[model samples]
Target: MATDGPNLASTYEYVIVGGGIGGITLAARLHARLPEASILVLEAGSDPSTHELATSASTVSAVRSNADLTWQLPIEPCKGLGNRSSIAQVGKGLSGSGAVNSAAWTRGPACDYDLWAHSVGDQGWSYESLLPYFKATECVRGMKINEDHHGYEGLIHVVPVKANWAKRTYPLRKAVQEAWAQSGVDYIEDGNAGDPLGLTELVEAWDEGKRQLPSKSFDLEGVDIVTDTLVHRVTFTQDQGHEPRAKGVELISGQHINATKEVIVSAGVYHTPKILILSGIGDPQTLVAHSIPLVHGNPEVGNNLRDHLSVALTWKLKHPEIGLALGSPLLTDPSYANGAPLDFIQFGRVPTNLHTEMLLTSKEDKALVLRPKACHTESILLYTYMGPHMSGVNVPMDGTYITTVTANLAPTSRGHVSIHSKDPQQPPKIDVNANDTEVDRHILREGLRNISKVLHETPSGQSFIDSQVPPEGYPVLLPDSKDEAYDVRIRDFGFTLDHPMGTAAMGKVVDASCRVIGVNGLRVVDASVFPVPIAAHIQVAVYALAARAADLIAKEQ
Candidate 1:
C-alpha cells in the first residue's frame, strides 16, 4: 500500500517478509483457505504497478528492468571469470525476480525435480507427486502439452507460438527448426511435460502480447500488503534451554510487527540468508563476529549457492534488407513486438566424452546418476542484434545481427551468499563462482559450439547466415574451435543468468516441509530452499514450489 495505513493490525497470525512470488502465493493460498486469518506481507520495494516496464514485453529487454526495481548486488572477483566481477540484478519488488527475469515458462525436465525427491528423501517432492501443484499455477490453454501433464484453468497465462496464429509466425522460425534438425537436434512437442532435451517452441508467461504481473495473476484479496518497508530481523519469543519460537519481525525503522503463530521469510536467495544471519539464526562464529548474540546456529544457512551463468555469441545475418529482424520496416506490424523476440529454445548436452573426462565430486556424480540425461546446455535465439555484449565488436544497429545466448544449465560450480555485517539493509555478498570448474567452462564453450554448429556446418544455416561477429582482437570461433579460444570468449564475456538458489537449502537448512531447522514457527519459502539447481527458467518450478509450500503450511495447522 502507499502507506502502512492507520487500520493496520497490531498482530497478525502470519508475518511474511518480502512480498515476492513466494510471499504472494503463500499469502494468497493461506488467506483463501482461512479467510479470517490475519496475514501481512512486508515488502522492501514499492508496488510494481508504478513501473510500466515491469509488465511490458514490447522489447528484447522484456526481462523486466527499472533500475529502481531491483537490489543492485555486486559480485566478488572470480578466478573463473578472469577476475572480472559483474553486477547481479536481484528483484526487490513484490513479485521478486519474476518481475525482472526473462519470462520464459520453461519447467525443466522431470529428472530435475525427481532427483530432488531422491536426495531429500521425500517422495512427495517428486515430479509425479508435485504435478498437481505445477498444474495449479499456469493456465495452459491452446498449447499442446503431454497428456495429463498440465492445467487448463490455472492463474498464470501461458501461450505457445503457432504458425497460423497472428504475429506468431516469426522470421527464421523455419530456419531455426531446420538448422537444429540438420544438426541432429530433433524437435519436441512439449518441453514442460517431462523433459526438454530437444528443440521446442518457445513458451512464455505472456498472454497474446501482454505479460501479467504476479499481483494480477494470483488471488490476494483481504491480505495486508505493506510496501516500501524493510525487515530488520525476525524476532523470537524464547525461554532459555529450548528452541526459540518466532514471534514476529522488527522493521528497519525499529517498528515492531507481531505474528502470533509464525513468521515466514520469502526473501530471494541472496537476501533470505542475510536476514536469517541478522536474526541470530546462522553460524555461531559469524554471529559472534558481528556482535550479535546467537539464538540458533546453522552453518549451512548461506552456503551451497548455485546459479546459471551465460554468454551471448552473435552472428551477423547474411541478409538484413529482407526485413526479418526487429526494427526492420517489413516487421513494423506492431504485433511483432508482442513477446520476447526469440523464436525457439534448444536444450541439449555437450559431448558426453568431455563430461566423463573431468573429475567430478560425489554430489555431482549422484546428481548426474539421477538426472542421467539432464540438460547441460540451453541456447536462446534473439532476432535482433545484441552486439553490445562484447566490447570492440562494432556492429551497426541496422538489425543485421542474430544472436545465440547459451547457458551452462547443469553447472557443478557452487558458490555462497553471506552477510558481512549484522545490518539487514546491507546486501549479502554473492560469489556465483562462475565457470569455477573445467567441466563448467567446457560446458559453456561446447554450448556455444553447439549453437555455432547449426550455422557453420548446416545447409539450413548457410542459406541465410554469413559470418561470425567476434570481438575485434579475436578470430571467429567456429564449432570446432580449440578449447583455448572458447575459454577466452567465456572468461572475458560470461554473465550470470540471474537464476540464483540453494542458499537456505532444503536438506541442510530446512526440513522437508520448509520449516527452518533448530527453530520453531519459522520457515523459508522461496528459491533459497531449493536443494539443487533446476535446469530451466526456474520461475515455473518456484511457482509450483510455492503452491506445495502453501499446502504443506495448511496441513500443519
Candidate 2:
C-alpha cells in the first residue's frame, strides 16, 4: 500500500515525514534555501482530490475518503472518558487536514505568535519577527488594503465569498459588534495585522470561486509526495557512546527510509509525541507503564495540553426569513446562488488560572454570554454555501449540528495525551478535561451572561423570536432566575470538540525551537507544539507555526 517516492536514497539531503501543510510548506522553503539539496516527503495519504463538488461543503463531507489519505484507525480503547475513545479525524492525504477542513483563513491577534515565542523562550519568534511570513503566504480578497494584512501574490490562493449565503451571514458581524459594545472593546477590520479585539468577516483559503488544494498550491514536482505510506517508527542508530540519533523511519510495509541530513518530524501533535515515546523519549513513568524502555525522562512530553473549550447556546429561528430561507426560491438562478445562512457571534480572551467557569457560575446566564464570546468567536471568518433550514423543530442531540455555537478561547484547565500501548497503531489517551479549571469555567459563565444580555437587544429579536429553548425546564444545576439558570444548563450539555491543542507542548518537552527536549534530529511543527492555544481558529496559526519552523530549520542548515 505504498507509493513510489523520489529517488533520494542515493543522495538525499533531507527526508521529511508527513506531507501535510507543514511538510509541503517546509519543502517549498527548503527548496528555496538549499536548492541543490534533494528532499523526499513521505506522506501516508493519497495524492489529492480533483472533485469540485467535494470541496463545497462545510463539514467532513467535503473530504474524499480515498485509501491513500485515510490511515489505520485507533488500535484499541483508551483509559480516559470511560475508555470510549473514538477514531481521530485527521487528514492523512497529501495536503492533510487542510484538504478537508472548513476553509476559514483566520489569523488571530499578533499577540498569539508573541505569546508562543515568550512561552517557549524562543528569540525572534515575536509577532514583529514573524509578520513577514504570515503576510507572505496570504492572498487577501474582498477588502482593500488586504495587501497590508495579506500577500497580494502567494502560492496559496485566498478568495472572498460573493454569494448570497455570505450576505445573509454578514449581519452576524454587526450583531456581535453591537453586543461587544456593552463590554467596551474596539473593532478591527482586519485581525491579521494584530489586535483581534472586535468582530470582522473572516478570510478563507479559496480560489477565484472555489477552495484551493495543497496539491495545486505547493510545488509538487521533483519533491516526492508519497501517499498511502504509513510510517510505523523512526529508525534510530546508536552513536559512538550509545546516544540515540534519529537516522530515518520505517514504513508499515517494511520499507526503510534513510535520511542523509535530517529526519524532520511534523506528524502533528497527537502522533509526534506518541512516536517520541515509542522511540523512548517521554516520561519515565509513562514509558515504564507501557513496557517500553526510556530514552530521555522528559515528564513534560505529554503534559500541558491546552484547548479552547466551546459551549453552544442554540435557538430555533422564529422565522425562516431571518437567515437564508428568504433566498430559497432563487437557488436555480445562477445570478443568486452560493450564499451563506447562519450568522456567527464569536469571542476570545486570555485564560484565567481558575478551576472552572461553568462550574462556579449560574446556568441560565451562562447560555446568554456564550452566544457572543466563548465558543465560535472569530474576528475574521467565512460564510459557507450551505443553508440551515430545518425541516422540523426537533432539537439536535449533537450540540452544534445545526445551531449557533459560541466559544471560549484560552482555558485554564490542562489535559494530557498518553500512550495506551507501545504499538504504533494504538491511539494515545486524549482526555480533554474540559470544564475542569474553575478559571476557564468562570470565563464561559461570564461570557454566556454577556451574550444573553445582547440577545435581549432590539435587533436580535428578529432572529430569536419564538426560537429559543428556555433553561427553566432543566433537571439539575437550576438557577433562581431566568438569566441565572440559562447559562448553567447550557454549560452542562453545551460542550464543544473543536480546537484541540497542546498535547506535545512547546517549551516544557519541546524547546523554543520546537525540537523535542533531549532528542537529536527531531522536531514538531503542529498544533501539538503550541505552548497554549492561540486566540483564534488554530488552523491558520498551525500553518504560521509551520512557516516559522520551516525558517528555523533552514537557518539551522
Q: Which candidate is the best by lDDT?
A: 1
Model 2 clash count equals 56
Instruction: Show the lowest summed lDDT stretch of 10 residues, model 2.
Output: 383-392
> What are the per-residue Cα lDDT tens digits for candidate 2 across 146-214?
455677766665544432344333434455455556545455556556665664444556553355666
Residue 396, candidate 1: alpha-carbon lDDT: 76
Off by over 4 Å in 1: 1-7, 59-65, 322-326, 354-358, 390-392
lDDT of 1 by residue, 1-557 (tens): 32443246679998888888888888888887778888898889877755777766673263434466788888888888899887788787778876776678888888888888887899888889989988888787564566498887888888776532556566677887899999999799888888889998788776666667686677787888888888889998788888899999988888888998889999989999999999999888889999987888989999888888888877878777632554577467766756777778899877766455545656654365235668898998777766575333667767787777899888878888888688777878788888888778878888888888888899999987888888878878897789899898888888878888889999999998999999999999999998878899888888888788878887777
lDDT for model 2: 0.58
Q: Please state the error at residue 342 of candidate 2 in Å.
A: 4.9
What's the CA error at residue 332 for candidate 2, in Å?
4.4
Superposed by TM-score, candidate 2 places the C-alpha of residue 468 at a distance from the truth, in angstroms, of 1.3
Q: Which runs of model 2 end up more than 4 angstroms from their true locations? A: 1-11, 51-54, 58-88, 160-186, 240-243, 325-327, 330-345, 348-402, 458-464, 470-492
